[model samples]
Target: MKKQAYNPYLPSWEYIPDGEPYVFGDRIYVYGSHDRFRGNAYCLNDYVCWSAPVDDLGDWRYEGVIYPKVSDPLNKDGSMCLYAPDVTVGPDGRYYLYYVLDKVSIISVAVCEEPAGRYEFYGYVHYADGTRLGERKGDEPQFDPGVLTEGDTTYLYTGFCGVGDRSRSGPMVTVLGPDMLTIVEEPIFIAPSEPFSEGSSFIEHEFFEAPSIRKRGDTYYFIYSSIVMHELCYATSKSPTKGFVYGGVVSSNCDMHIHSYKPARKPMYYGSNNHGSIIEIKGQWYIFYHRHTDGTNFSRQGCAELIKFREDGSIIQPEMTSCGLNGGPLAGKGEYPAYLACNLFCKDEEIYTPLEVCGWTAGSLK
Candidate 1:
């Protein structure tokens, strides 16, 4: 038998010896989030960050609590618990993190000169005019922060729950200062009225959250959870701040692939896939997102899958259990099904060959 081309992908609990894997670099960092089961015991869930080299996911070196609820009385730090976080090596060589500041939905920024250090809170990433964007009075505000950069410009994309309803405020992007601690642009709505965003925990919690963005060639792709907690959908735009059109939904539910309606086993997956991020490793794009785990008590943990891009500029997220890159590298893989279809502008035209009929398979492009 021939050896497999790549290493097998492992989910969080299966990889890291303890806690849930949160971010990755030379090692995968696992962090603990406040799970709902812990009722009134003082919800101060400690976020202990641990790192394990990718070559050996089973062993981890505890990195300690990189960010703890601060002692400040004025900030949510008093009661807020940190949720999932996205870590990035800032252009300035510093480590920047954009993470949810608990149920209140505030997205805060912290920086560390090193990847695994005690991060210091650096105030909110305010709007371009120096005013904090998206902070509404009396509003619990939003959650989850995903940051991206194009050329010399940097944008901080965050989402929040809408008031008087469970639907989310949808994902929005704001420009960030070179320092990454301040906002430099007005918030721009990227996915308004997110299609298929019906009953997902994000929606049930009041809106679509858990947003991840990636840029391929000249186009930008934003992958987000749809209607239910198990569905993933994406939107694409040439400009990060405008004209983003919803593409479609991909299901991680074992029984089906992509669906527009609720199925019986859905909202199940209790290791329901949500919060995720995209990073290019060795020139290929891979998605790292969390899924539900079924221990004596169910919890959410992280997983990785390879992602492919269509020739027309959309992302092709395949279904199945695979490593972070989805199907692996596309350098010489055949052409992707996405490229076979015309640009979204051709959405109204029917002059096209059927998908399965053509050799354009539905996953990471060849």
Candidate 2:
């Protein structure tokens, strides 16, 4: 008998998406929105975590529930589900969580002293006019907040989708005050030009979703899902908020095998929003993204692959793999969690997929 490789990292029962990976205190922790297994609707559960020592990706352990949906103010209206989030170490040496309430599209912040621990709701981001964004723009949406705390200042990157349109203010970066709560400056747009945004396939759609910001050497890498929607594209700049040049692509949620994707008459994997960051764990670089499971977007599971960068700082697209964090196949003997199965097959020749939180599925594509 041969050993099988693992992809989702955790056991099959745990469904987590929008994975944001970070390294702290000799351990690499993954923070992502918890998805209900076999459930409907995107991000139907709270935020949970999984982590492993920096030396061993195969030793992943559940970090328990970090944040609950019921604690959110929107829970009063029964419409709150935590979305994708990013955490940064503040100047005061605390971890700050940045995310948006799913329905309201309002960016909220949470704070805790430790990663993957209980987080207390902090506050909502506001504008220079002193009006909270949630109150000012009821119709307009501003969600998917990514934060980078460098030196004494923290930069918050947010996306404001134009109503009924995909393109809007381009990549926005705002400076946050010391509390990591209030906006310190008017948001600046790090515009992606025609050459950089090979992603803007639809003129009507721009800066679609999922943002991650990191600084390598002196260059700032602003990673997000551009107009291409499914693929994770990136732009780089010396400055965090301006002069961004599109740096090809990172990877696609459905098509991780290659970069050049032509429009097809047929469909692909259950395409959901792709959210992850490029983090250097130990000395290796990896692209962390999620894949749809059980033939539904809502039941998505997190997956990652190792990546290499060119001398020019452009990333080579990585292929989807079953050996995701593990580096190799698991031993034939040992108890493994359900989430780690990569090659799922049917019990029989029949396939009968069910409705997920999104309410519809085609019964194909495992």
**Worst ten-residue run, lDDT, model 2?**
345-354
Quality of model 1 by C-alpha lDDT:
0.50
> What are the runs in model 2 whose C-alpha is more than 4 Å off?
1-5, 134-140, 160-167, 192-206, 256-270, 328-366
State the lDDT of candidate 2 residue by residue for 1-366, as single tens digits. 222436776677888888888999989898888889868788888788888888877778888888887767757554777888899999999999988887775678889989878998887777766676545653245678888998768998877443344435455777887878777776776754223344544232346678789888798888787555556777788988777776767866655335344233222344456778888888888888887777666787888878889998989876555675655545557665544443333332112223432333223212
lDDT (10s digit) by residue, model 1, range 236-283: 778878776676543342213423343433322222335555555545
Candidate 1 local Cα displacement, residue 330, angstroms: 22
Cα lDDT for residue 263, model 2?
Answer: 35
| Residue 147 alpha-carbon offset, candidate 2, angstroms | 0.6
- CA lDDT scores, all candidates in order: 0.50, 0.71
TM-score of 1: 0.65
- Count of clashes, each model: 27, 11
Error of 2 at 182 (Å): 1.6
lDDT of 1 at 249: 49
lDDT of predicted model 2: 0.71
